[model samples]
Target: MPLDAESEAIGTLLLDRGILSPDQLLTAEDHARDWGVSLVKVLLSRRWITSDQLYEQLSYHYDLPLVDLMEHRPDDTLIRKYDPRMMNDRMTVPIKESDGVLTVATARPGPETLLYVRKTYGPRVHMVIASHFDLSWSLQRAFREQHSHEAVFALAEIDPEMSAQQVITPPQILVLYLLLSIFLLGIAFAPVPTLIVLNVLLTVFYTGNFLFKAVLVWVGGAAQESSSRAIAAEAGLLRDEDLPTYTVLVPMFREPEVLPILTQALRNLDYPLAKLDIKIVLEEGDHETIEAARSLNLEGVFEIIRVPASHPQTKPKACNFALRYSQGDFLVIFDAEDKPEPDQLKKVVAAFNQSPDNTACIQCRLNYYNARENWLTRMFTLDYSLWFDLMLPGLERLKVPIPLGGTSNHFRMDVLRELNAWDPFNVTEDADLGIRLTQKGYRVGVIDSTTFEEANVSIPNWIRQRSRWIKGYMQTFLVHSRRPIHLWRSIGPAGVFGFVFFIGGTFLSGLLNPVFWAVFAIWMIFGEDIISPYFPLPVLYLSMLNLLAGNALLIYLTMVAPFRRRWTYLAPWGVTVIGYWVLMTIASYKALSQLVFNPFYWEKTQHGLSKHTANEVAEASADVEEAKG
Candidate 1:
């Protein structure tokens, strides 16, 4: 397609003024053509000149006065009159109205924008050039409250059943009451048989849990091997010009010190910088991190989205707020401490291409970079290796709903929007969204790529993070299980069983481990005579088998987890995972207490505590300085 007269004029003006060299101009033009973007965007994305210089040249070319939106803020009333989404999409905003004429601010002063402004905001509007950052910040300031409200309440209002706002519903409560009543009455009437039945049920549950996990490991081990290789080949073959724009959301809260590590990691991604739409999503109250972002003076492709201070100050809510401003065909969330493999995004793109049209998400594997740091870190790494590398693939192989990892899960923007994104009320919003996607007729695929994250070195910090995750799991199980028939119809019997063992059983096991251990200890200490009435021979034998075999199976699974990555040194640490489970039991209790008292509370996990991450942060900061110099 030929450029419009105004676009050609702007390009020519840049050359005449020596703002862009001839070779740079030619390269940018080719990129602009290939990327389906304007010459201004191509130049800006390349960082050939500062935004001020480009906007100033734009002001000169268009014979329009350049305005600083921050100094002369836009009118809230006038901005509210127009659709915010439309305004953001077009990168234009109505600044002020005076004497029947509206003064509008726009980053792009072109023919199309001129026509749109005239057609939408009346012909008497005056146009002014503003830098993209300034315009975006102004919009954020003007609509902060509205967007915040929407981010927190949109899912609840749009799909109440999927939201965790209500936590336990009326019907679920009634069912729980009925179960409790039955248990109490049975204990009151027939003690021995009731205890026997209870013992049998728990033993069966324990057996099924271990069996399900073993099955997952077996199936997941081989799942997608050929497909993953094919996807990697396709990813290698993908052309840069043909690559689509990808939005990366990095939501941070009070972790300014580690910002450089994340930024450096993102910069290392093997993708075209011009096509990366990276947003640093931060809370309005996090002044330190916000200031740190400004000090970096990142490229034009990186935008800092200042999320308004809102209740449920969660990463999901911040992501939801930033989602409104994101313009991409695909979107992904990365934590502040994440360092994904360079080809991870490309692999995700390829996976999506080969997947069914119903596929809405492609989850990548996750593990820790500081696996050898300590026992806790090693255990955490092994756990992640099992969950992401093994169990997730199993879920995919069986066509079950795969609960997403906290980060590195990519999504199709259209389906994400249609589903109202993540539920703000669910602390483990990623996991909940995965199940919700399956229920909504969308498939979630798992790829073989990995994202390395900082492992928790401190036990207290680990507990806080784990507790939040367990609480979120509880919320997901309760929310999905509310409509048993609906869930069954949506995900099928296989999925229901997976959900029970995977989601419900995760927290339940944590709570049940100590109880079983206590029972075993009592039997050993007091002998069989004290509790022989309650524990019959068959039930007692089954319980012992479940106790012994279940732990051994889990230990074997953990030992094998690190074999894929050839991190065999960490395999010996798997035997000591019993200590890790004890910590999980503590977290589970905390999670239960929080779920009962304060369900929506987000337990903030402090990062940059590990020695490895601290060293990386220092190195990253030095690299930033070198780049600047």
Candidate 2:
């Protein structure tokens, strides 16, 4: 039975019986054009019609013959008499016995086999298990266990207008006002060397900060290098069976175009589908995507979780809703445009199982699939590769709280649930969660997993995404630092130093780098004589050394990251990353401004509209074809 013939026959039978409307028949024909499955299978999978409803419709409308599978039983003795070899040779054959019925599992059971079973076995055959490469995986588990009700209610309760209130006065303006007030007071009171002492103290504080950063980076790098070797050695001996269930949550929004691609990628994962619980978390209002998902008719292993419309329409909120329904022992998150390496989950699983107790989370390496899409993407990818693959692992090895990447983070379910999932209020939920985990005495480790995500290929899009991230980092900084003494006591000195160097370093560096760049530029433009004579050689030398050391660490970080990725060709992008940070500085300022005015307003970065490599376009097109078919 050819697919076209089977579909046509089914359609004709349904039409004659008045079971299907003329419009529905036409729709079925259109659906069958690309999909290599029967109309019945497609309809059933799509939830447009159910098995019981179809039978009822056929009986009433067409006077067609229908047999209930539940009432049937195959010849048990005959099934048991057949050898395994003989059973394997046939397209459809009875394999085993249970009670008085035979169990018939098939490789490619055509309608003829179904008809033969009905006629020969008197429609009483107990079970018909058709095994094919593209069977419609049942969504029974999704409906039974998924948190759709909670997600729906959550969406309704979500306040989209929720934003950060501007309480912190602009530091620049405040500093200037303080300085002016001090100058005015100085003219009147003129005796104390307050300004001189203040300047000296500021100089010392900055110098110490710079030195501390340099030392931490060195220590972090050494720790990471050693850890990598240990992981590699351990990886060699680990087996797949030892690993536990790994849940991958993919939160989607207006992502109809990318769903098929994501689906295909997940299907290609090396992990066992039965053990892998992949949750496709979608927003309630996204009907287009929901419909698109139904059409895919993916395996039973894939579940669609609808996130109710909630205020603070952030990714974390959606994740939190999905977390309620997740069934895996360990959970991981992937963004809409991610194409992680198939073995990435396995690596995390292996790492977690080997060191089960201490490790609460494993942050995988994230790079961009479309790095060469444009200058912005290329720079973005390089920066990420450096951060995740180099800096984070190093930070973790040194027993520091690693600021997690937005995606590809695997966590122990109980630990994650204990933390109440990601902060609904925090925009950069991943980073905030990482800090929170550290506070809870849980350790986050790094694995050899590589997840390739879409970089923001355009400047404006890049800015929006980066701004949100920076703003979130600022929020995390404030939330944790509110109890400074307690934070110090909790994480200890080294951990506190790591937080300052990594988390605080990001904020401070972005804020101050532009000032440093301006000074350097002014010096370059004017003659050496025109420069401030008061600025001594020691100050200049220290500043220069600080800049040099930062650059060297960056280079080493970049080199180490791509080496881990086996993408050594991209190592040269370290030089270009400095220019990228200039963009980050710009974004930081924008984020600071928006943080107070519109904290919850998500800076939307549009995707799937890139004019990158031909290969990407072709692949995307193929995905569309597969989805439609």
Candidate 3:
């Protein structure tokens, strides 16, 4: 019952029976050889043969009856005779029981499942061929969550008022109200004392925030020397036979333009198509994207998972809906516009093999494909380089809870399921999950892979995208802070310190940046004499340090970031990071406004706007291949 390369139920048998043409077989064989997939899987992927046709060929080859699982539902009594684990793990599902005989539909009739059925149901156990997808769907129907509702929970269910109140809890709101009330009373009652206290608090907070980021920047710069670069897996060292199944969840919404691009990019991946469970998760309403996907004539392996319309429609929710259908041992996410390196998955496999047992996820670096599209893009690229290329690895080294990027996060299927996958409620479910993973005594690592994405060039588009991200960060900060003591205990003091500095500091800096910039501008134009009346020497020194020293450190980090990728021309654009941060400041205020009004709103960043097309990426890929050649 072992899986044999020249099995009667597969390849040669189909050709022998004229079920497939010799040319088709040769093409499928070539794809199989290159991609490390079986001929059957390759044929299916290319739509050269339907699953039913393959099964019919299989049945003819094996001299066994072919059963359509969709036509025959398995009863509970017969299912209980043999463990569903056999069906779940072995790709075989029990179909029906007859007079002292049991029939089962099998994709692969493994020795273990065969033995179990024979022992349990006696020697009259009948084996029949069925398509893998059909058997899998049947197994799911037989045992898994019957409804999407069971799997994907909404924000309203977890917190009745969270989607309404945004991230600010009722208690936090009350506390804020009280604090504001007290502040008003204090200003009215004792203006001098109140002003002094407020100035001192602001000075301390700003100084600490500046110092914290400065240290992180320094640490990142230092960590650059100690690279966490993973060597690509040697082709022969890990054979295709040993490779585990991989799932790629690509969640898209109104992304019709990127459909063909995404499909081509994914098809170009070096991983085995047979082993890949690539789900193109689309909102049910996204007809254009769905139709576009269909128009591409994509391989059957690239499945379209239409997520049911639900309240708080988000990417994570769509991912959760798709997650149920995944058959991979490891799962990863890709954005609609992302073009990951061909060997990205292989590197992740290598990274996971080298990492410790506690490691649950590994995040790859993200950069822009159209980095030189415009000034805005150039600055955005620099900003991302600073964040992903430098700071993330530094954070990983420090053992802090790393906020995960939206895409290219590879996770162990078991661990992901244990954590209930992703928080449907959290807007930035990716980052929130990273924190959650850390708190649950798991670690996330950084891999030396990059997924290229399109950088938003338009200012209005940038604001919308940045605001949603900022809003999500605010949401995460509030959610974690709700149980400050518990979170501290879970992550420990160092973790708490990091969470506060990284999450809290990031949002706070953006929010407070404009206020300080305005003051600095006023001081620059009119001299310090006007503001010097209220500021003590110590406060003035701290303010100067926070403004000059902090901004200088950040600018330095931004400048050095591009050097990591040998993007020397982009390095000068680092100075424009200040302008970028100002944009972020504007976005932050917009985020705050939205938090009060449209909390659960997803400011969807439209993709396929870059001038760079799929052909450009394809040519780049070809160039890499040519270099290898």
Candidate 2 local Cα displacement, residue 557, angstroms: 4.9
- lDDT value, residue 597 of candidate 2: 81
Q: RMSDs, each prediction? A: 2.1, 13.0, 4.6
Per-residue lDDT tens digits for candidate 3, residues 92-198, read 66788788677877775445657766775679889887877676656555544333564455434553332322467778888889999999999999976787788
Between candidates 2 and 3, the one scoring higher on lDDT is 3
Clashes of each: 0, 18, 0
The residue-by-residue lDDT of candidate 1 on 135-214, one tens digit each, is 88877878888888989999999899999999999999999999999999999999788988888888889999999999
Each model's lDDT? 0.91, 0.65, 0.77
lDDT of 2 by residue, 1-629 (tens): 23477567768877887767898787766654534445654454333454456545534333333333334433444544443223322334553455766555443345676676566445555534433211111111223223333333332244211212222335534765999888778756862345444434444545656555445445555555655556656655555445566678998888787776687778677665545667888877899988988777665446677766656687887887767656678998988778888877766766776674867898888888887767777677767766765567667767777788889898999888666667666678889878878877888888766888777767888888888888888777766665567789878788888787667767667777776777678878995665455345665566666567756666566545566557677777666777787888988888888777887676667777665434554675576566545
Task: Please give me the total number of clashing residue pairs in predicted model 2.
Answer: 18
Best by TM-score: 1
Model 1 vs truth, CA RMSD: 2.1
| TM-scores for candidates 1 onward, in order | 0.95, 0.68, 0.86
Q: Residue 558 error for model 3, in Å?
A: 1.4
Candidate 1 vs candidate 3: the TM-score winner is: 1
Candidate 2, residue 570: lDDT: 72
